[model samples]
Target: MTDAAAGARTTAPILLGVVPFGLVAGVTAVEAGMSPVQAVAMSVVVFAGASQLAAIELVGDTAPVAVIVATALVINLRFVMYSASIAPYLRRLGAPARWVSAYVLTDQAYAVSLAEFRETAPGERSRLWYYLGSALSLWVTWQVATAVGAVAGAAVPAGLSLEFAVPLTFLALLVPAVEDRHTAAVAAVSGVVGVGAAVLPFDLGIVTAGAVGVAVGVALDLRTGAFPVTGDGEPMGDGGRERETDDAAGERGGERR
Candidate 1:
């Protein structure tokens, strides 16, 4: 199967999980007193569901704009890690393509695309197409679902427990990603720390837990020699592959000259 088609197919199940969250986000926005245009626009522009929900709740509480913005930023801080993890795979893309990629870098897209990238050969040209396929599918589904929720208003019943899908989807992705003792330890530490830190202000708990987990993982790696860092501060395994590719390309060019 083609990369894009494969990506779209892989993402289909998760799309079902996202629908209710999108619908809830739309309904919540209107119930929170935002105009229809504003609600839809937020979904289109921000495109981050958890942050949107947080921002809407803050707005409903009549929080200051600065507070709302800061809260949203903190809640979305995981995107920084996501961007860093995906950067090497996408570095060859031009500025505009990279920008588009960044814009559509949601949790589902990142999870599926990153798994695909790690398994696929490094030099394959279909990675970006696959990512785009997953992202576009998500984008369209979110917009349509949110629009429906906005129009339906509160008529969508709350007892449906639509929110469960979000965590369920993450859990599905997380299960396969935890491949070793160190990774399992990291996940355990991060989940516990995140929950323990949940009372922190400005939604800082998630970010703090992530930082602590990463630090523990890095220290473990250093002791085990699993992920030694090069002088350039890149992970030795993947970075070495990139450097070898560059050197080989340069040698071929010189020979031709």
Candidate 2:
């Protein structure tokens, strides 16, 4: 399958997990007194469900605009770590493509794409296409689901417990993504720190937990050489092989001939 096609296929199953979350976000926005247009616009523009939900809850409580913005930004801080982790693979893309990729980056996209990128032989991977395919699928699904929720606001029953789907989605991705002891430690530390810090003001706990988790993970990786480096200073894949370039493959073929 083409890279994009593969990404879409890989992403399809996860999309089901996000549907209820998207609906909750949309329904919550409307319940917070936002008009349907405003609710759907937030889905289209902000596109981060967790932050959107936080913002909507704050709005419902009549929080100040500055507080809402700050809270949303703080809650979304994990994107920084996600960006740093994926930068190595996407650095070769042009500026426009990179910008689009950055905009579409999400937990699902990052989890799926990073897993695929780490497993595939580098020479055979099309990182951008895979990323775009996964992200765009999410974008479209979120928009549609949010729109449905907005229109069906208050009509959908409250006992559905749709909000639970959000965490479940992350849990589904988290299991397979934690490939080694270092990552498992990172997850454990982050979850513990996040819970302990949950009482912090302005939802800063999430940010604190993410930063600590990343730091712990990186320190362990460096100490253990979990991330092997190629001779050219590029990081090797999980298999300890440097990604082969097309030219390098051609050279090997010629040599064999």
Candidate 3:
């Protein structure tokens, strides 16, 4: 397929995924004590998902504004790695272009764009379009969802458990991304830390758990030479093969993706 066509096709799933995520963010922001206007403004101005959610969660807890901002920064710091990952592609795109691209760099857009960029031949390349399309879809969906969720958050029963939807979304995203022993080890470590830290007050456990997870993942990657290994240190496996297998199993087992 031509790069243009491939980029467009690969971006469709992101549109679908963003609809629910955006709405969830909106609703949660309202629940976090923002007015509808403020909640919607957040979706428009700061489109990063985890950071926005972290901010809302902090506000809900009545935490200091500095702590809330700090948590948002921690959650969003991953984007620095993402920007570096895609820097080679964006370097020649000019400063304003690069900044715009960076602004729209959500996880869903990054995932789909990187996959398309790798697949497309240079002569047919269109990474920018793929990223833009996916990001636009997500941005629009999030705004609409937030509006809906603001209304629905009031009517939805606490017992029906809509709160799980956001984390469940992350789990779906994360499970697919964990295709190696190194990542699996990190996830295990994070889970252990989170469980152990559950007694901590005011959701600090989440921050600790995320730090432990990242530290474990980084340590495992260094130990295994997964991040910078030259040829043939270990057998080459599909980076996403484990994710595919688990998703297949989930389908068969009637498990949620």
TM-score ranking from best candidate downward: 2, 1, 3
For model 1, give the RMSD to the true fold. Answer: 3.5
TM-score of structure candidate 1: 0.87
Clashing pairs in 3: 22-142, 23-145, 23-146, 26-146
Q: All predictions: root-mean-square deviation over Cα?
A: 3.5, 2.9, 11.4
Q: What tens-digit string does per-residue lDDT give for candidate 3 at 1-257? A: 34435544565654555666666677777778888888878777877776787788888999998888777776676677677666655445766767888887877777667655544434212556656666666666677877777767666555655555566655655676666787688778888888899788545676688777767766877776655221422112343334456667989889552
Candidate 3 at residue 7, lDDT?
A: 48
How big is the positional error of residue 93 in model 1, measured in Å on the Cα after superposition? 1.4
What shift in Å separates residue 192 of candidate 1 from its native position after superposition? 0.6
Give, for candidate 2, the lowest lDDT window spanning 10 residues. 238-247
Instruction: Give lDDT per model, in order.
Output: 0.85, 0.86, 0.66
On lDDT, the candidate that comes out on top is 2
lDDT of 2 by residue, 1-257 (tens): 37788888999999998899999998999999999999998888899988999999999999999999999998898999899888877766788898999899999999999898778755324778888889999999999999999999999999999989988998999998887787899999999999999999878998999899888987997898877445654547854363446558889999999
Distance from true position, residue 15, model 1, in Å? 1.1
Pairwise lDDT winner, candidates 1 and 2: 2
Question: Could you say which candidate leads in TM-score?
Answer: 2
